[model samples]
Target chain A: MRLELKEVASGYGHRTLIRRISLVVTDGEVLCLLGPNGSGKTTLFKTILGLIRLQGGQILLDGEDISRWPRARLARVMGYIPQAHNPPFPYRVLDVVLMGRTAHLGPTAAPGREDMAVARRAINTLNISHLEDRIYTEISGGERQLVLIARALAQEPRLLIMDEATSALDFGNQLLVLSHIKRLAQMGLAIIMASHFPDHALLYASKVMLLKKGQVYSLGRPEEMVTEENLKSLYGVDVKIIRAELPGCNETRVCVPVCR
Target chain B: MAVARKQGSLTNSLATAEGNYRWREIALTALPLLVFLFSFPLGRYPISPGQLLTILAAKVFPIAPTWPATLETVVFQVRLPRMLAAMLVGAALATAGAAYQGMFKNPLVSPDILGASAGAGFGAALAIYFSLGVVGIQVSSFLFGLLAVGLTWALSSRIRHDPVLILVLAGILMGTLFSSGTSLIKYVADPYDKLPAITFWLMGSLAAIAPRDVWTALVPILVGTLPLYLLRWRLNVLSLGEEEARSLGLDTGRLRLIVILCSTLITAASVAISGMIGWVGLIIPHLARMLVGPNYRELLPAAILIGSAYLLLVDDLARVLTSVEIPLGILTSIIGAPFFLYLLLNARRGWV
Candidate 1:
């Protein structure tokens, strides 16, 4: 196991935003958090990543207490890409990816040839090598998200935490980013991403975590957790469950949210 | 086994990064050194290149004891310290400007636009209004300049989490208030002696710089500059807004505080000595950004080199134009304002 959050509770300034959230992500696992707009999904990621103070409970990484880890040490172990990464100045796409190596960089140490090579490889992995020298701000939203994922890849972390990283992408770009995430997990990374779409969670994730009202509503396999009843309860809309097979794999479709 | 594989890959990547970065550092440092060395021989008192080299060698090395008195005086007493001081102050202001722009995440930000220069002028003007002697003027100007910056900082930061717009607005408001007070002081001063002194001081000239003033200015400037070098990379990350910087393991509040403190002190210290020399801080960093991209590690040093070259080239023109020493602000404004307009019109959108 790479990351395990045990009964974790956290919030901002005396307000308890998320509570009793327990989950474990093993290597090669894609665990997606499904919730509505105010369902504390982002807060859960922040608590696990230690961006906000954890009010209660323990977060352990490889059996070490995550609370005790210094931020730089935590960064080396786990990489995070927030939903919105706005750049005030126009940095080249390659430069943005190279920033992932910052945790490894020393006080006066420079970004070297190897760092560029890794950045290049990550960009290639995301099929964004052609956009390497383009201005980050000028690129389309989908391209920026891929570049940011490449940045996360450059960190070479055991666990990746993404908060709505694919929310800005179109339908096809959304699938592309999730497939990239699936590939990273297949390569032994533990991914915990907060996403609004339950369909995507069911499509690619090995595990699904349902958060409701600052608590974990359910945590288990996506096959059992993403049922028609669970979708209706979580999203307060009736959902129809359907199963189909794609050319290469099985597909589980929950169609009630689409009806109305 | 997986940990071993990952560790091996990480090290391989790191080693490559280190190698590339080292060459860039060498190139950056070397180019600036060569340019700084060559700038010294360019002025009209133009020692023959050979004589200039000979004079430099004699001073730096003990083997050559005999040197011409006039050459020695021109190189050591007259030109050397002035040139070195110009280089140091230019580097200080431009680097500080780059740091300030990064901290604020605004390309238009400059060292003096925050009101440090206006405050320094007001402080110096107050000293003149009292008819204080030379010692009195320098001391009061230095102290009041510091005080004005302190006031601006306090006012801007009064409400924790003040927006950048609010901070900028406060600086502008404070700057206008101080400038008006200075105008009032100028109006009341005696027209004959005090008025001309104030006018010339406001216009800014390096003609009166002495070796002693250089030493006095060096202490605060260097003290403020060291922190910037240590924090250069962090400043680059800081340009991505406060929340992202914090999540990346940087103490954004502390880093911002340290940067604001250092850049403000450096600006106030330089303005205290140089008397509101404009555009070296404002324009040079923009040119550096255009040349080297927004990465502060490269941009900072580039700004230093280009800024020194700029001020020295312009100062050289100022001296050769007439027997009357032209105010540096007038010269820099004439040169920088047009170039800035050209950049605004020509640069690609979002490049800044």
Candidate 2:
């Protein structure tokens, strides 16, 4: 399915934070939304997920207007991986993932064998089978992120939206997750992710949209849109872009800050 | 998935394999049935277990009834209904308590968190002061209990920020309001006839429960309970906080409405029948949680059985341990407060 946003505007309670933004993401494309803090990135993501009311304009999924779709019907077609949260109760990992199938099960129905099979398949696909019975609270942050991804995968959605999914992870875990996210897009899932790092977009994103001061700065292929001047203008920081080549890894550009 | 679930160290002592609590559940179920059977014969009427069995059998199967007419009346008309009322009250309070704890996402919550007990108390006091009969008192209590919660919900829904926090605050306000109203009634009542009756009603008992009161309360209690039972599994998701639940496609507002309605119905029904039986609602669900983990699918049913068994046992002790009847509320508080402290001190054992 293709998600097309036309002149969408959104914010909290009469105050329009983001306005007049248009974008289209199709299957097998990774749309990386790059913005500084308070630049309407989170607000836009919430609007797409229907967590907040839309201020104006229209959102269409596969040529159908989805501006006011029921949350359950919307959930069946779209999956979301929010930032990791500490649950007050310690649910089993498998049970947490099985919640992704809520749209498929009856309101009162327990997870049947078929639903369990689907959950098991998701756990296997995410390589989290070993963590299935473990208490979710006792797991490490990296493991929790993987489990959440497995939960979204269990939903079997065509469109995947993530909000700052890697902002809390360490370097090694961040690379581990970013590569996995790239692979998911390669497997024909349409993905929109907000990230603070432009180098990640340069390395992994098919398209990048830079948001600044509640408006879109630029939108295009990462190679064409991302530049040294734009990075400085977006973040108010001076930086140098260098090509880094390492053994047994692909050559890539890295962003390094320059002190005055 | 590949089944390589080695039981971890943290869960080694308290947790069994998932789905392997079947034996413990069976034991819990058996304890309740034993308590129910034994409770029937332990009342003030001089009847042995064998004699009780004979009376029951003679009734079910038409043999020559060889019991005294007075014994039969005491057994069937008085003791039997009281026993059933005790069981029903206990089960309703405990299950409602469990649902409220999960609904509010706080283990400290009780069935009366929404001013139910206080409202019922005020209503009963008002009824007694005006010389309302038994049914009048019950209906008034039920209606006021609902009114208290309805006021709380209405007040909280107006504010959009931090809805749960506002709801808890509203409940506290309503609780204080109704409790003060009850106190006001007590202060001016004629210290002879109406005051003692109001005091007794507030202390709570199953002494006045007849087959009719049981039938009256039973319908609402069962009507309230069916929704909770059918929707038990969903409670786990609902307890995961509203934003997360909505992300998982749960209609959280609707689910909360249903849960609040059911819990209020059961709580109001029980409090109307027996005055303000305390501790059972707060303590029994915790015991259930300690035995089974926090999965609502298991926890809710476990709570119902344990609550039924516990109140039955407590009622027996209330009658047999004293000459004149001891109030149910006092006994429960005397027992429930210490257990609550213990649970708080050792919260690692599944209170979370």
lDDT of 1 by residue, B118-214 (tens): 8888888998889786556667777766666677777877754444666677778778988998999899999998888898888877777767777
| Candidate 1 residue pairs in backbone clash | A112-B17, A113-B16, A113-B17, A114-B16, A114-B17, A239-A256, A240-A256
For model 2, what TM-score is found for chain B?
A: 0.93
Residue-wise C-alpha lDDT for candidate 2, range A1-260, written one tens digit per residue: 89999999999877999999999999989999998999999899888888888889899999898877877888888888988777766778988898888877788987888888988998887788989989887798888888888888888889888888988998988888888889899999999999999888988899999999888999998877778899989998998888888888877777889987
Q: Candidate 1, which CAPRI tier? A: acceptable
* TM-scores for all predictions: 0.83, 0.94
Which numbered prediction scores highest in DockQ against the true structure? Answer: 2
Model 1 local distance difference test score: 0.79
Q: Candidate 2: deviation at residue B185, Å?
A: 1.9
Candidate 1 structure quality by residue, lDDT tens digits, A188-251:
8889888888777878889998988988889898889888888888888877767777787666
For model 2 the local lDDT of residue B261 reads: 94
- Model 1 scores a TM of 0.83
Share of reference contacts kept by candidate 2: 0.44
Task: Encode model 2's per-residue lDDT on B100-130: one tens digit a residue.
Answer: 8888888888988888888888888999999
